[model samples]
Target chain A: MMIPTPSALAYVPFVSVANMMRLVHSLGPEHFLSELAAYIEEDFRRWPDFDKTPRIASHSRDGVIELMPTADAESYGFKYVNGHPKNTRTGHQTVTAFGVLSSVATGYPLLLSEMTLLTALRTAATSALVGRYLAPEGARVMALIGNGAQCEFQALAFRALCGIGTLRLYDIDPGATAKAARNLRAQGFDVTECRDAIQAVEGAQIITTCTADKQYATILTDNMVGAGVHINAIGGDCPGKTELHRDILLRADIFVEYPEQTRIEGEIQQLDPDHPVTELWQVMRGTVEGRRNARQITLFDSVGFATEDFSALRYVADQVRGTDFHEPLDLMADPDDPRDLFGMLMRARDA
Target chain B: MMIPTPSALAYVPFVSVANMMRLVHSLGPEHFLSELAAYIEEDFRRWPDFDKTPRIASHSRDGVIELMPTADAESYGFKYVNGHPKNTRTGHQTVTAFGVLSSVATGYPLLLSEMTLLTALRTAATSALVGRYLAPEGARVMALIGNGAQCEFQALAFRALCGIGTLRLYDIDPGATAKAARNLRAQGFDVTECRDAIQAVEGAQIITTCTADKQYATILTDNMVGAGVHINAIGGDCPGKTELHRDILLRADIFVEYPEQTRIEGEIQQLDPDHPVTELWQVMRGTVEGRRNARQITLFDSVGFATEDFSALRYVADQVRGTDFHEPLDLMADPDDPRDLFGMLMRARDA
Candidate 1:
C-alpha cells in the first residue's frame, strides 16, 4: 500500500533558543519588550473572557516543574517550565521554559517557542506595565534588589514602558550586582552598584525586589520601604518563597494578575486567605482607579500568571511570521486517510 | 565579546514524526508493542510510588485539549494531546500528541518526542496487556468494532500478547473496516470483514470496541455481549463519549486504570460514581484476581492514564540511547554565568 505524503498541517513552527536571541536582537530588546507589553496589556483588558487556572505544579526536593495552561475562545496555550535554585551552582539556569500555542477549533499547535528568555521578557514587561500605572508620576529612578538573570530585562522594560532612566542594583552576591550594573550602564542608563538593599531603595520612587532564593527571604523589610513608592515583588513566586516582610504587604494597596493564584504563589501568600487585593485587569479596564494618591503605597504583587505567558507566546507567533527565525518541525502524524495511520507508517519504510 | 557556543546541556533529544516512523520500522511493530506493554506493566506494578491526577482538560465548542502530567521520584512526564473528530474530514488526524520527560532533580527536559504514534502504540499495548488477564483461555478469535486508526494496532497487540490469530472487523463506515481488514491481513492475521457488530462478535471470545465519536455511543449492548467474553472498551475516553451500553457495564466485572479518572471519562462514567471496579495494578501485583470463573464477563474500562504515557516516554528514552532516531534541539538557555543571561544575549550578536 502506497500512502500519500504528509500535508502542511503536520508541520509546527519551532523557535529555538538561538533563533529567539536572533529575533530579540533583530527587533531590539527594548522594542520587543514594548510590543510584548502591549500584547499583555491587551489580554489583561479582556481578562474576564479567559479560561484561568492556577498552574499545575509537581514539586520535588530540588525544584519544581509547572504546567501553566490557559485559553481564550479562539486559541489555547500552555508553558512547561522549571525552577531550581541549586542549578546555578552546576552551571545550569535557575529557570528554563518552553511553550506551545494551538488552535482551539482544530486542536493543532501553531507555534512552539523557547520561553526562558520570553518568560524574562514577559515578567519584565508585566512589571514595567504595572509600574506605569502605580508609580509616582514622572518617577525615573528605580531600585532593583535582585540583580540576577531577570534584572537587566526588567531594567530595559522599565526604560521602554515606564521611561525610567536611572537604576540602583543590589544582589546578595556582589558578582551578580556588578554584572547588572555593567549591562545597564552599557544600555545607556545611569546605573549604581549599591552596597545593600537599604541603599538600593534610597531615593527611588520604585522598589523592585526580584531575589531568587527558594525561601522566605526578607529582601525588603518594613522600614526600608518608604511611603509613596511602588513596590514590584517578582521573586517570591512559589510556595514558601516570600520577598518582603509581612508588614510591608499590610501597608500597601496590592494589585494582582489573578487573585486565586497570587494568593498561593505570590508574596500575598504571607497574608490571610481573605485579604483584600485589587485585580490589575480591573485597573487596566478603568473600572477601578490606580494610585489613588501620591502616597498611597501601591504594590504590584507579581506572581507571573499563565495569561502573561499566553500573551507572550501569541506575540512571538505573530512576530515569527514570514521570517527565518523559526524552523518547521514534523511533529504531527498526518495520514493519507485519517484512519490509515498504520498504513502510512508501513509505507514510510520505503518512502 | 563573543558568546561561547551553548553547552551540551542546552540540547534536548527530539524524536520527530519521520524519525519515529523509522524507529518503529527498525524494531517491527509487534516487538515495539510487546516492549511498550512490558514497560507499562512494570510501571503499573509499582503504582503506589508515583504521583497521580486526572488529566487536566480545556474543553472548547469543537473539541478538547488536555495536559496529562505525572511524576515519580526520579522523572517527570507529561503529554499534550487534542481530540477533534471533525479534523479528519479536513484531512487532519482526529487525535495528535507530543510529550516530554524530564529529570525531577534538575527539572530539565530529557526527551521531547512525537507521541501520536507512541500514544497509539501505548494505548493498544495497554488494552492487550489487560487482555492477557481478562480474555478467555486459548481464545484465538477476536471481534473488532469501530475500525478506525486504532483498529490495526489493537489487532496486532492482541495477537502478540494474547495469541489471538483471527480478526473479525466491523465499522459504521465500511471504508474503515475494509482498511483495517487489508492492513491486518497483510500483517498475517486471519481476517473477516463482517457486515455488522452482531456478525463481528458471532464466534469471537474477545471484543475490542474503539470508536472515535464524541458522544454516548452504543457499539454493543448487554444482549450483544456473550458469557465469558473479555470486553476492551477503548473509545469512550472523554466525558460524554462512551461505547458499550450501560447494561453491559452493569454485568461485567470492570477493571480500571485509575478509578477517579475512569469514573469521569471511561465507559464507567455511565454507571454510578461509586461503582466497585478493580484496579489493574492490584491484579498485576497478584493482590486481586482478574478473572475468577469461566463464565464471568470481564471489562477493562481504559481511559488511558499519565503513568502509561510516562512509561512509554521512559521506554523511548532508553531505546534511543546511542541511536540516530532523535535530533538535538537547542531548547534551553545555558549561559556560562547563570546570572549573566543578558550578557549572553549581548554576546550572541557577535557569535
Candidate 2:
C-alpha cells in the first residue's frame, strides 16, 4: 500500500514578516489602522465576554520574555514577546513578537503570524480607538514626543481615526525626528520637527509620550501636560519605566485597560494602590463617562493588554482567510488513524 | 534606496512535522529515545537549575489548551499543547503540540518545532528512564494495558534503555491491540495479545497502564498488581482521571515528577493531601531511595512536567544543528536600524 499524505488538518496558515507587510500595504496603512481600530473597539465594547489573563512573564537579568494569552467563546489567542533593553545596541529590535490564533472548540491553531509589525499596528490602532472615546471633540493636531519606530504608525492611526491633520515631532536624537518628519511628509501629513517637547505641544490638542528609555524619566512633567489635552503615555509599560511625571497621573482622570495589570506596569504605578481610575472598557460601553468636559485632563495609561492582541489576531485571521497572503505550514501531526500514531510512523519508512 | 531584507536575527529555525520525522529516522527512534532520556535525566539530576513553571491552561467544555513554559539560566522553552477527547471522533488526534526554544540572554527564539512526535518520544523516554531505576533488575517482559499510539513507543524505549525483550499488550478495543502488536512485532519483540487487562499483567516485571479514557478508570485492581513489579501509570494525568485502584496506591511506594502539579493531576490525587510521595528528581539525585527490595512495589505516577519538554527541545536543537531537518522561518521583523522600523516599512513599498 502507498503511504498516506498529511491531511489538511495538519497544516496551519502562517503569515510571515514579508506577508504581513504585504497584507498591510494591500490595505493602506491608514485604511488598515481604521479597520483594525474598529475591530478593537468592537472587542472593547463586549470586553466582559473575554477571559482576561495575567501575562506569564519570565524575567532575566537583561530582559523579560512574556506569554500573553486570552480567549473568547469561539477563539483563543496568545502572543510570545520579549523586551530586551540592550537589544538596540546590537542592531536588533528592543521588542519582538509572534502570535498564534486557535479554535476554542478543537484546540487547533488556525493561524500563526509574525506579530512584530502586527503589534505595532495594533498598538497604534488601540491608541486611536481609545482616542475616539476620550480625546477632545474635533481634535486636529497631535504632538508626538518620541519619533522612533512607532512614531509614523501612531501618526497614521490618529489621522485615520481621529481626523488629526498635522503632527509636531520631537526626540532626543535629531536623526529620529528627521526620520519621522521625512516619513510623515511622504505620507502626505503636515509634519513639523520641533527642537523641544514644549514646542511640539504648543498648539496641539493631543500629546503622546512614547520614549523608549527603560528607566523612569520624566518625558512629560506635570507643567508640560496642559488641561483638556489627552495624554497618551505609551512608554511607561513596565515597572520602574514611567514616562509621565507623578503629578500628571494625580491631576488627570486616568483610564486603563485591565487595572489589575496597569497598576503594576502603567504610569499609574506611581500612584497609591487605592487611587481611583476608570476602566476604559466601561467607558467604551457607555456605563461610565469619558472626557466629561473640554477642560478636563484625560490621561490614558496605555499599558497594552492581551485582549488587544486577541482582536489583532482576529482581524488578521479574517483578512487573510482566502487570500494569497499566507502559507500553509505543517505545524501539527495528524495520523491516518487517530489511535495509530506509531503505525503511521512505521509506514513513513516505507514511503 | 534599496530595501534591506530581514537580517539573520529575524529568522528562527523551524522543524515541521516532516522534518521532525526525518530527524527522528536519521537517528533511529530507539536511539533517539535513549539520547532524549539521557538529556531528560541530566536535567533531572540538577533540577534546581531550572525555573519550573506552572502550565497555563484555557479550559472549554469539550477540550483544553495549555502553554507550558520553563527556563534555565541559559535557555528558555515553552510548548503549546491541547487535549480534546472528542477530537478522535472527527479524525483528529486527541492531543497535538508544538514548542519554541529561546535564548535567555537575548530573549530571542532559537528554534520552533512540531512537538507532537517529540512529545510522544519524550513521554516514553521519561517512563523508561524511570524504569531503569525503579523496575526490577534484568527485567525482560513488560505488560502494556493500553495498546494505543503510545504502547509501541513504550516497548521500544524500554527495550533500548533497559533491555526489555518481550511485550504483552491489551486494550478495550481489540483493533488497537492488534495494531500495537503488529507494530511492535515488526521491530523484533516477542509479542502477546492478551484477552484482558488481567491477562496482560500476569508474570510481567513491568506494568505500564496508558489508557486514554478521560474519566476515572480501574484498569488495574488491587489484587491484579503483583509485588516487585514497577507500575508506570501515565493515562491518569489529569484531575478525575485515574487508572489504578486506591488500595493499590496505598500499598505502593509512589514517585512523582513535581509534587505541586502531581498532587492535583496524578493518581495520588485520590489520597490525602499530606500523603508522602518521593520526588523523582531527588531519587535520581541520590537524595532519596528509588526501590530498595525486590518484593516492594514501586509505582511511578507520572505527570509530565515542563522541564522534560525543555530537555526535548534542547535535544532537538542540538541534534539538528547542521542538518536540513529544519528551515529558516521569517518569524520576526528586523529593521536595519533598530529604531527606524517605520523607515524600513516605507522602503519595502518599492521592493
Candidate 3:
C-alpha cells in the first residue's frame, strides 16, 4: 500500500521598495504620474466594487499611526502610515509610510514598496487630478502654505499636471520655506517666499495647505480666501488637525474623497455631519458641478484614502511588470507537498 | 544666496522571517518556547497598556482575509493573515500569515516576519499556556482531532509545556492521521491512530479539534464529551464556522481570549451573544476558577487575537537580538536633513 503524497504549489512574486523606486524612476516621472492618474480615475469610476472602511487608527499623545486597507475581488492593498508633529525635532520626517499590494485570490503579497516617496507622488497626483475639475482654467499661481517635505512635490506636480508656472510659499519655519523656494527654483518654478500665510494666499488662483501641526489652527481664514480659488487642504488629515477655518468650510463648495471617513478625519470634521459635500469622483464623472462659477471658492478636503493607494499600487505593478528593476524575494514557501509544512522546515533545517 | 539643503534622518531596523527562523533555530526551540511563554505571560499581565480592536475581516466565498492591528505608546504591530480551506485542494496551506512590528515614535517597520510558522508555534504555546491552568493536573493523554499542519506543533508544545506524553489522533482523511502519527512518532510522542473522532476522544483528558472546513460542521457533539475534558476549539474561527454543537457549548464552562471578538468569530458564535463566558486572563490571574470539578467540561474558544501576535513579536525580537541570524535591510531612510526626503531619492539616484 502506497502512502498519499502532498501536491506542489507555485511561488508568489514580491517587489521591494528599492527595486520599485528604480522601476518608477526608470519609467520617468511624467509617464508614472500620467499612468497613476489614469488608474486612480478608473478605480474611482468603479468605486462600488471595493470593500471600503474607515482606516483603523491608533492614537497617542504625540502622534497617530494608521492602517488603511482596501480590497477588490482580485487585489488587496494597504498602507502603514504615521503622523508625528514633533518628529522633525528629532530630525525625522513628520510623516513616513510604506505599503503592500497583494493578490486577494491567493492572499500572497506581490509588492512591498516604500510609500514615503510614493505617497508624496500620489498625494500631489491626486491633488492635481482634482484640480483639473475644481481649479479655474488657465490657473497659473498656487499659494503653497506649510512649505515642508511635501511642498516641492506639490509644486512639481502642478507644474507638470496643472500648468502652474509660479508658487507663493509660506511656513512658520523660515528654513522650510527657504528649502521649498530653493527646490522650486532648481526645478525651474518662479518662487515667491512670503512672510505670512495671508501674503502667500494673496492673488493666488489656487491655495494648498500641507502643514504638519496637530492642532486646529486656522491657517487659511475666510478673509484670506479669494473668489475662484481652489483650496487643496492636505495637512488636516486627523481628528483635531485642521488647516482651514470652520468659516472657510461653510463658505466654500466642499469636496471629499470618502464622506464617511472625511467626516471624522478631514476639515469636514469641523462641519456638521449633515453638511452636504460632493465626492471627487462625482465631480470627475460630471455628475456634480465642480466649480459652478469662476469666482466660487472650491475646497478639496484632501484626506488621503486607501483607494488612492490601491490605484498607485496597481499603476506601480503595471509599470514594473516587464522591467528589470524588481528583485523577487523568497517570501512564500512552495513545498512539494503542501500538507508537509513541517517537512519543508525539516528540509531547511537539514540543508 | 545659498541653496537650502534637505534634512537627513536616522535608519530603522528590519528583521525578516527567514532571518528570524535561523535566529530561533540557533537559539534552540526549547529556549525559544520558554522565552515566548514568558513574553506572552508578561504582556498578558499588562493588557491594559495596549490599544486593542477586534480584527477587521473581509470574507469571500472561498476564504477570509483579516487585518489584526494593535499598539501601545511605544510600539505598533499588525498581522495580515488568511484562512482558505480550499487552498489545500490547490496544494496550498489552509492558513498563511505575515506580520510587521514597528516603532510608534518613528513609524518605521522594525521587523517583517513570516507568521505562518510563527503562528503554529505561538498557537501551540498559547494552547499549552492555557492548558497549564485549565487542564486537569497530570493530564497525560491528549486527543488531537483533525490532524493537519498544526498537529506536530501542538504535540511538541504539550510535551514540552504541559507534560502530555501521548496523542490520540484522528482525521476524516486517514492520510492526514497517518501523517500526524508519523510526524509525532519521529518527535518521540506515543501516538495512537484512531478511526473516528469518538475513538480519538475516548480516553484523553484534553480534546483539541482544529478542523479546517469553513462551515458549521460539528466535530464534537455534547454526547461524545466527558467530565474534566479541557477542549481547545481551534479551527471554527469565522462566522458560520464552528466545531462544537450548541449543546456542547451549553454543557461546557466556556473561556475565551477576547470576549468581544470571540463572541463573533469563535465557537461561541453558536451560543447566544450574552452567553456567560469567562475570559482566560481572569483564570490566569486567579480572578476566576478555571475548573470547578473533575467532571466539568471546560471549553476554550480560541479565536486568535492581535495581542498574541504582539506577544510573539516581542518574544522573537528578544530572542533574535545578539544573534548573527538577522540581515539588516535599509528599509527606512534616515536622511541628515529631515525635510529633505527628496534628497534621499537624489542620493540614491546619484549612488
Candidate 4:
C-alpha cells in the first residue's frame, strides 16, 4: 500500500478546542502528560539548537497580549496569547491562546491549535518534569495554591509524573477551590480543601503557586516555605507580577528556563540583576545538579518559554497525524503561478 | 422592537480569498484602490500615534518568515508574512500573508483576513499615495520595472491616485512582462512592453521597481535614472537584498516610512549610516517638503511596514461589516467563566 502524504502545503491542520480535548482524552491524560514531558525534555536536552527570544508583548491598560515565537532547524512555532484578569468579570477567558507550527523550509503553517488548553497541559508537564529532578525523593503530597483553571492539571501531572498522591488545594475564592477539588475527586486523586495558603502548604513536599494576579502579591511567604521542598512558581510571568515573597526567593536556590527572560519576568525580577540562577536546561542536560542536599530549597521560576509551546505543538501535531480530530484550514493563498497572484484572484471571480 | 447588537465579542470575522476578491470587485477595483489609498494616507497622516518597529524576521536558507505587529491606543493589528522566491516552482506564492486586527481594550481579535491580496492592494495604494506627493505635475506615464505579482496593482493604483494612464513595463523574463501587459491592457491601460530596463524608463514620469530577488541587483543603474523621476523601489526589502545601484541612491533624495527600518532593509543600506533622508510620514503630515524642484530626483524607498498592513486590515474590517463577504470565525475560546477553562473543556466532552 502506498502511504499518502499530508497535504500541509495546501491545507493547514487546525485543532480546535473540542478536538484538542478529544486528542488529550484519546492519549489518556496521564499518558499524554508523560509523553509531552518527554518531548519537552528532548527539546530541552538540545536547548542550544533552537532560537530563543523573550516573547514580544503589547501592554494595555487592562491586560497584555504576547506573541511567543521560536524555531528549530526543521520547524517554527508561535503562540498568540492574551492575559486579561478583568476578562473573567465579563465572562471571557482571562488567558486564551492559539498557536501555529510551520515548516522551516517552506514557511508554511502545518498545524494550528487552540493553545489555551495545551498551555495548561504543557505547563503542568514542565513543572512535574522539574519536580522529578528537583523535588525530594519519593515526594507524595503537593500543596496547589491559588486553585483556578490550572489547578487540576498540575495536580494530575504531579500525581502521574512525581508520584504525588494527595493534593492540598486553596484559593482566595472558596468556589475556585471547590471546583478544583470536585474535578480532582473525579480523577481519583486524594483531594484536600484548605482554608488558606498556610493550611494548604502543611505536610506537603511540593508547593505550586499558579495564581492569576497582575500585581506583586505574595501567595507564598518565606515563613510558610521550609527546606527540602520544591517551589514551582508559574504565576510571576510578567513584569510587576510575582507570587513568592522576596525573602522566599532569597532563601531558595533559583533555577530558570532562559535566565535572561526569567530575570525580567520571573520571581527573580524582585532580586538583583546579577543574582545567580542555573538554567533548567543545564540541569536537565545533566551538566548541572538539580537537588544537592536534604535541606536545599530548589525553586523553578518558570516564566513560560517558547520551547515548551513548541513542544506542545509538536505533541498535538503528532497525536492528530492520521486522526479526524483536526481539520484543514486554507489559511495561505497558493496559486498555479507564484508571480500570478493577481491572475489567481481574478480567476476566483469565474470559479 | 428590540435592536440586536453585533455578535463581535463572540465571533471574529474572517475574509477568505474568495471573499476578498468579491469585496474588491464589489467596490470596483479602481474605487477600492482610491479608498484603500485614502486609508493608507490617513494612517500616514497620524503616523506618530502608532507603535512602530521593524518586523521580526526568521531567516532560513532559502527565504524568511516575518511577523509585523503594531498597535494604537484603541486597536492592535499584526501580519504573518513569508517570502520564498523559489516557491513558485512548487506552485506556491512567493509572498503569502494573513493578518489579524484586535481590540486593545479587550485583547480580542475582531477580524482575521488573508493578507496576500490586501497586501498587494495596500502596497499599490501606498506607492500611489506617495507618488501623488513626489511625482511631478501632470505625470501620466509610468515605467514599471520588474513586473511580477505587484505589477498590475502598481499600474492601476497610479492611474487611480496619481492620474497615470500609460504604463511602460519591462522584466528580465518576457513572460512576466507579457502577463502584466495582458492584465493591464484588459483594465484599459495604454500598456507598452519595453525591450530592456533602459528602454522602459524613456519618457516615463514615475518609475516603480518591484522585483523579487535575494541579492544586490541593479535593475536601474545611475545612468538609466534621469532627474525629476519619483522612483518607487519595493523589491530590496531584506538585508543584502537591494535593487538600485548605489550611485543611484547618491543622486536621489530618498524618503522612507520608518528611518530606523529603512536604513537596514531598504536601498539606503548601501549608503552611509547617517545619510540624510526624509521620512515619508513627515511629508504626508506636511512637516517636510515632498518635491522641492522639478529637476530634483525623489526616491521613495518602499520596504513594506506594519502600519500599512494595519490600514489594510482596518479597511477590510470596515468594508465587510454587516456584509456576507465575511463569515464569523470561532477563533478564540470564550468560556462562560474565564477561571473555569477546564470546566468548559469537560462540558464540551459531555456535549
Note the clash tally of each candidate.
Answer: 0, 0, 11, 0
Candidate 1 structure quality by residue, lDDT tens digits, A93-186: 8999999999999999999999999999999999999998899998999999999999999999999999999999899999999889888888
The lDDT values for all models are: 0.93, 0.90, 0.80, 0.87
Question: What fraction of the native interface does candidate 2 get right in terms of contacts?
Answer: 0.80
Residues B1-351, candidate 4: write the lDDT tens digits: 112122345466878766888899889888999999899889989998998888888888888888899999989999888888787777777888888898887788888888888999999999999999999888899999998899989988999999999999999999999999987897899999999999999999899999998899999999998889889999999998999999989999999999989898999999999999999889999999999999989999999999999999999999999999987765666556567666666666566
**Residue pairs with backbone atoms closer than 3 Å in model 4 (clashes):** none
Q: Report the error of model 3 at residue B297, Å.
A: 0.9
- lDDT of model 2 at residue B93? 82
Sorted by lDDT (best first), the order is 1, 2, 4, 3
RMSD of 2: 1.6
Clashing pairs in 2: none
Q: After TM-score superposition, what is the CA distance of residue A55 in candidate 1 from its true location, in Å?
A: 0.5
Report the error of model 2 at residue A104, Å: 1.5
| Model 3 / residue A169 / CA error / Å | 0.7
lDDT of 4 at A103: 82
- Correct interface contacts retained, every candidate: 0.85, 0.80, 0.32, 0.58
TM-score order, best first, reads: 1, 2, 4, 3
Least accurate stretch of 10 residues (summed lDDT) in model 1 chain A? A1-10
